[model samples]
Structures are given as structure tokens and as C-alpha cells.
Target: MKTQKLKFTFLVFIFSFSNLFSQYTEIINSNNPGFSESPYSVGSGVYQFESSFFLKNLSTNTPTSLDNSWGVDLAFRTSFFLERLEFDAALTFQRDRLLGNFTNAYTINSGLSKIMVGAKYLIFESTYKDKSKEIRSWKRRFAFDTKRLIPSIAVFAGVNTDFVSDVYKTNTVSPRIGILLQNELSNYFNVITNFFYDFIGTNFSEYQLTITGTYNFNDRWSWFLENQTIFQQNQTNTSFAGGLAFLFNKDLQINTSARFLREAGNNGSYITLGLSYRINRHVDSYKLLDENGNEIIDTPINRYNNKRKGFFNRIFSIFKKKNKGNKTRNRGKRKRNN
Candidate 1:
């Protein structure tokens, strides 16, 4: 009787372990092509600001704790005129608030926070550069190059620090490898996708895929869908967002988006207002490195550190092209008022 009981206990343990990890099956992202559609490549300059929020529905069976978190991201990049060489920096800040009908309530000052920085370079080039202009905006003709394999790939590694409480904290340097592909199936639509995987010590690895599609019906009106999934620790949550993008002119894009998130223990959803703007920057070649690097000065876009470049590059580039057309101006018919 004793021997039979011991065997039964061992079998129960194995089954439970297998059941917990079965949700690790991978998901391939389809909307990533939309995100990678802009042409601000390695040596070019680019800037973006984004904010997102995550809300959770707490469990009912027992006393549970959950958090609603908000985060902001600031990123800059420069391409070295080489198109395949560049450097970039992305900083993120996240704060969360927790509440429940329990004795211990959670607060933003002591929840969870994180920040990260890294670099990427190009290793391969695709012939997907032949693309059409957006219906209304001439400024974004080759906004995002569409290709399935961006092979001239780069590597990135960075340090992450998280604040959980005053007395306890976790700090580690984590590395990530990323691949992006963009595709154009026809004149009316474009697709883009980006895949990234992060390893955090013994914690379960995180895999995220972002996919989006941009459909242009005319010069002023466009439609888009954004899809994302966060896979970790034997669970996967997915969300879908759809929005209408209004392109008023070259300098601005006003977009409103509705979002939804679904997972095993929680369901989340939110609506957001998104604005994307472009401030043109013209710069020289790239060769400036931050504190830590092997080839630190990687891209043309990230080197806005010099105020001199920020002021003169834009003013000079706009008129420089016109100077080349001076001969054409001289040859064209002109009636003198003399």
C-alpha cells in the first residue's frame, strides 16, 4: 500500500508541471510591417513619444493583488548617410497603482518601475526600397521600407533597473536580438512586423510581436490596425487596436485608437489619443559614442547631442537642394519687370 501511494504522488507532480508550461507555444505577428514602414533608417534622424496603460481585473476566488500601470518612452536615432550604420537610445519609465478590498493596499511610490538603453546596426539590405508615396503627404514617400528579411542585422544589450520597494530592488543587464520585416502587397496597403525576445535572469523570457497595417483611401484619410502579444511565464496575452489616421499635412498625424487585452486570469482594455510629428533634421556623418560601446557611434539619427547639428542641419538641407536647381531656374522662361 505504501509503495503504491508514493508512485501516485510522483505522477501527480509531473502532470502539474507539464500543465503549467503548456501555454508556451509561440505566436507569429502579422502587423509588424506597419511599424517598420518608415524610412528613417540607420544614418537618418528620428524621434518619437509614446504612452500606454495596462489595467487588470482582480481575481475573485481569494484575496488577490493586481496593478494598473502607465509608461512613457522617448527614443532618438541617426543614420550616418551610409543607410546601414546608426545608433539609438530608448528610455522607458513605468509606474503602477494597486488597490483591493484587503488590509494591504498598493501605491505607485512602491509598485514597479523599469528603464533600459541599447544600440542596433544594420547587416543586410533588401531591394524593397521601391515604394509609392502616401496619398496626401510627399514627405513620407519611403517612410518604411518593406522587406521580409532585414539580414544586415544588428545586436543590442542594455542594463535594466526596477524599483519594487524602498528596502528591496533588482538590477540586471539584459540583452535582446530583434528582426523586422516590411512588405507591400499592392498600392493601397502596407504591412510591417517586429519580433523581440528578452531574457531576464531565471525569470521566464519575454517575447513580444507588434504588427500593423496602413491602408490609404485618399490623401487625407487612412485606416490602420495594430496587434500585439506579450508571452511570458507560461501565459500569453494578446490585444487588438484599430484606428483612423488623419494626415493633415507633412508635419503632423492625428490618430485616435481603441485597445483591448485578453489573457488567462485577466482582461484589459483602454482607448488612447496618439499624435506623431516630424521635425526634419539634416546632419553630417556618424561617429559619436556614449559611455559604453565597441562600435558605439552606430547610426546617423541618434547624434542630436550636438546643438550645432540640430540648428544648422535642417536650415541648410532644405535650401541646399534648391541650389542644385539654379541652372534650371536660369534656363526657364522669366519675364523681367525692367
Candidate 2:
């Protein structure tokens, strides 16, 4: 009888603890589960910085007593454009820290939160002029840029090295491909669908999909909504986020938002604030200014813009010339004037 009772007790303990067995949870949540925000939409040759504190890993079903582990990400985005073609790269530095129970917390550091480089191509662009001309009103313009709907689809593929924690089972280089589909439904609103799939699979294959939207109340103020669902071959969670976006100026933006997460019978909420500077890689900022201690590239806007103009002007000149009604006369006038 004693032995049988002991075995029964052990089985009970295992059953109760099994729900707490979580493999891993996403360390980052600034954008949708699958997609990251663009530096262009945020600003131009800028650094993107995000800091977050997570109450729980939400990896499993353990109930948290209170405030817990946290994470941070610092990143940069730079781009050069030639006519309608844009070449951009995003580099991110990541750190994630995990703390055991707050009372007796022992910090366990895992693989790099994020170490990845992504290349992007802009498939569509709409100008302030086009947007303003159509919307017509400083008030409307203040509400937002009279921009064109990208009605665009862009592709991104990158290799990331995640220094997974020794505590967890995953250890590998994660390669991923993503599709960003964006459309401006109106002068004040835009919707985007982010789809991403990781080639490398954890115990469960990794898949994420998010539907996000931004509504501009004015050029400087906007409302943003995001719904992201993350699925592993074995487990899954659905998260929702909403927040306000403030454009401080033409080149800088501060995005402050809130995120709410739900997993099985567990639920939690938190706030996030992000700042970014956009980089237009037209000029040689290396010569004009010194690099930030951690920056991968150095360059400024106006010069970079001009450099891109020269390149695109060459590649797309044929189409540009055809659009110019007085091309021959303009050429002759320039020649004669010179």
C-alpha cells in the first residue's frame, strides 16, 4: 500500500507540473508577431531602439507572482533609392534576460536576442505632393501625408543566429522569409498583412501571421492596431496590440503602444515605446560625420538622396525622358545654354 501511494503521488505531481513545461516564447513584440516595422515609415538614416520588460516568458502555464524578466533591442536601418527602386538593409542587436522567480531570481541568459541582417526592396512609393494634391487642405495634410497606396508587396529574407538558452532545447541558425503586403486605403488609413515562415523548425515548425493597420488622425498623431497569431507545431498563442503613434517631425517618430497577450488560460498586458531615425543612404556620411560607436555605416540624408538621384536618373532616364514632353527642346536648350 505504501509503495502504491508513493507512485500515485508522483504521478499527481507530474500531472500538475506538466502544464508548466513551456519550450520558448517570443522575445520581441514591437511589431506583429511575424513582421517588423520599417525604418522608412518611421523616419529616414536612423537608428531603431526598443526596450521592453516582460512580466513572464509566457512560455508555459506557470502563474507569475509579479514583475519579472525583461529584454532590449537596438537596431539600425539604412537605405538608398534609385527612382522607384529602393535598396535597404536593417541590422539589429539583441539581448534578452530571463529571471527565475522574483523572490529567488537567478538570471539565465540565452542566445543573442537577435542578430540578423535583412535586405529590403521598396516596390511602391507615393509622394507628399501626390497625397496633398488629392487630399487638399492643410488640416487634412496635418492629419497625414497625401501619399499613394503602395498597393505593394515586398519580400525579405534573412539569416539570424539565436543564442538559445542552454535551458531550452533549440540551438540553430534561423533562416526566414517574409512577405509584407501594404495598402493605403485612404489618406488617413493603411492596412498591412505580414506573413513569415521560418525554414528551420523548432520542436514545432514556426509560423506567424499578423494583420496590422495604422490610422492617421493627423500627420503627427495616429492610431495603430495589430493582431498577431504565433503558432508552433506544438503550441500557439494569439496576441493583440493597439497604441498611438506620434510623428515629431519629418525625420523622427516616437511610437508608444500597448500590447495584450493571451495564451490558453493565461493573460497579460504591457506597454511599449519605440523611437527610430530613417536613413537615406545617398550621401557619404562617413566623411561628413563620425560613426556612432556601434553603427555599421555612416551617412546623411541630403547627400545620400543626391547619390541615389544620379543612379536612378541613369537607369530610368528613358522612361523619364519619354514623360518629358519637350525632351528634345530641353536637351537642346541645356546644350546651348551650357
Candidate 3:
């Protein structure tokens, strides 16, 4: 009986440990092929790269009548100090051809369009109850978890540099800040939202909001729909995009997306082909557990300094103490009988 009880306690402790470190997953988490970003970070010690190549066409009713552009967007992401924190850099380079409305002459321009360095730190994370553990009723197992309504939130701050081509250079370095939110509605569906203020204290400042929804068809196939809006001093721009992604393996993904844009004086569209890959070198920290499934500090000083304990550990410690008391009583009774 004691042996069986110890085995059960060990299994429970293992399950709880995995649940506590849920931020890390075996698969790579990439934010790509969409304008919005996820609040979750690539797990600590993982390096990820995402890139997209695109062609764009725009028609305006103003002086510049028609514009054709091709661009490549590149991003590098990595996490280090904490599982909830990530650092990233992004770059965009584009070539554009503009047609004059009156003269019908073409003007060509090419250069780096954007460069930014940023960091994201998760502030709040919500955990939902595991419905799969329910064995009594199917309804309970399949019911929606209300905790899904509360999103995991992260904050992002970045600096935009003036190191770009003359055509798109701001001449002034500026700051950007944003809030990212994500809700995992189910095993197959997720929604992410981002609100950003870009080019702070600059003449070309803007506010951007993006919402993206993704649905997984299976382990390897997924699709996403996104809408992004930019609010500027003079006019507002909006875009709608949809895409599909295929996971070639745990560390690589390929995707394609198309976006339609509407601005104050121009209508534009772009198609993107993207790839995401990661180098995962994450290692879990070691923990020590006692026979009754309680985490044990190896040193007396460490045990004295740590006060908080897991709920399961506290509950099992009570049973462990009670069992010891029962053993003492049994031994006393045998002595009295002798």
C-alpha cells in the first residue's frame, strides 16, 4: 500500500511540474506571415528567424498615380534571461517605381525602408483548467473554459533608426511602443491583438492596431485572417489579409499571404511568401522532490528562505505526517500486546 501511494504521488508531482513550466513547448513558436505579433515569446535559449518577400501595387488619385513596389522583410528573434522575455530586430528594404499623373513619366526609388530593434516581455499569463482530466461526464470534458476570456498580455518597446535610404529616411531616431494580447480560445483556435504607437515625437507619427485570428486544421496545417489599421494625422489606412501556413517540421514553417489595402487616396494590394525557422537549445531546470511529492530544498538555508510551496505538496505533506503517526501508534500497540 505504501509503495503504491508513493508511486501515485510521484506521478502527480511530475504532472504538476510540467504544467508549471507551460511557457516552453517542444515546437517552435513563430510570429510571421502576418502583421500582428503573438504575446508569447520563443522559449528561452531559442533563436528564430522569419522573413517574407512581397510585391505590391498601389493606385492613387493624386500626383503619383500608380506605384509598383517589391520588398523583403526580415526579422530575428531570441530569448535569454527569462522564458517570458524576447528580443528582436526587423529590417525592410524596398524598390518603388512611381508614375506621374500629368507627365506619365516613371520615377524610380530604392533603399532600406525600415529598421528597428525591440524587446517583448510578457506581463500577465492566464492558465485554464485541464478538461481532459475529467472522466465522469463528456459534457464537462468538452465545455468551454471561461478563463479563456482573459488574455495573456505582453509589452513591447523599440527604437527606430534613421539609417535608411534617402527616399524613406526620417533623419530623426524615434521610439515605438505597443501592447500585445493573445487569447487561446481552444486547442485549434487562437486570437492575437496588437496596439502600437510608432515614430514617437516625429512628423510621421502613427497609431496602428492589428487583430489576427488563426485556426489549426491539424498538426501541420493552419490558416490565419488579419486586419490592420493605421491612424495618422491626415488620413487612415486599413488592410485585410489572409494566409495559410504549413509546418514542415517542428522547427520550420512556410507560408503565403495576400493583403488588400485601402487608404485615403490610394488602393493597394500585396502578396507575400514567407519562411520561419528556429534553432532550439532550450534546457529545463532541475528540481528535487521528496518521496511524498513535495519539492525539497537541498540546503537548510535554502529551505528556510523559500516559504511558498505548491498546493499539492502541502496536501500530500499532511497525508505523509498522518501516515507516520499511524505507524507510531501501531508500533506502540504491538509493544503493549507483548
Which segments of model 3 are wrong by more than 4 Å?
Answer: 5-9, 291-294, 299-338
* Candidates 2 and 3, the one with greater lDDT: 3
Q: What digit string (tens of lDDT, one per residue) describes model 1 on residues 56-78? A: 33332223334465554344544
Question: Compared with the true structure, what per-residue lDDT tens digits does model 3 show for residues 1-338?
Answer: 88987787677778767866666778877787899999888877788999999999887746674478998999999988887898999999999888876776888888999999999999999789888889999999999999999999999999999888898887899999999999999989999999999999998799999999999999999999999999999999999999999999999999999999887878899899999999988887645566666776677756654553656776677766443343433444445554
Q: Write the per-residue lDDT of candidate 2 for residues 19-74, one digit (tens) a residue.
A: 22211111111232213443122222233343333233444324332233444445
- Compared with the true structure, all predictions reach lDDT values of 0.51, 0.52, 0.88
In model 2, the Cα lDDT at residue 46 comes to 30
Error of 2 at 111 (Å): 6.9
Please report how far candidate 1 places residue 223 from its true position, in Å.
2.4
List the candidate 2 regions with Cα displacement exceeding 4 Å: 1-67, 81-111, 123-150, 162-169, 199-201, 279-338
In the predicted model 3, the residue pairs found to clash are none
Predicted structure 3: lDDT: 0.88
Report the lDDT of model 2 for residue 336.
50
Listed per model in order, the count of residue pairs whose N, CA or C atoms clash below 3 Å is: 36, 20, 0
As for lDDT, the candidate ahead, 1 or 3, is: 3
TM-score of each: 0.55, 0.55, 0.84
For residue 256, model 2's alpha carbon misses the true position, in angstroms, by: 1.3
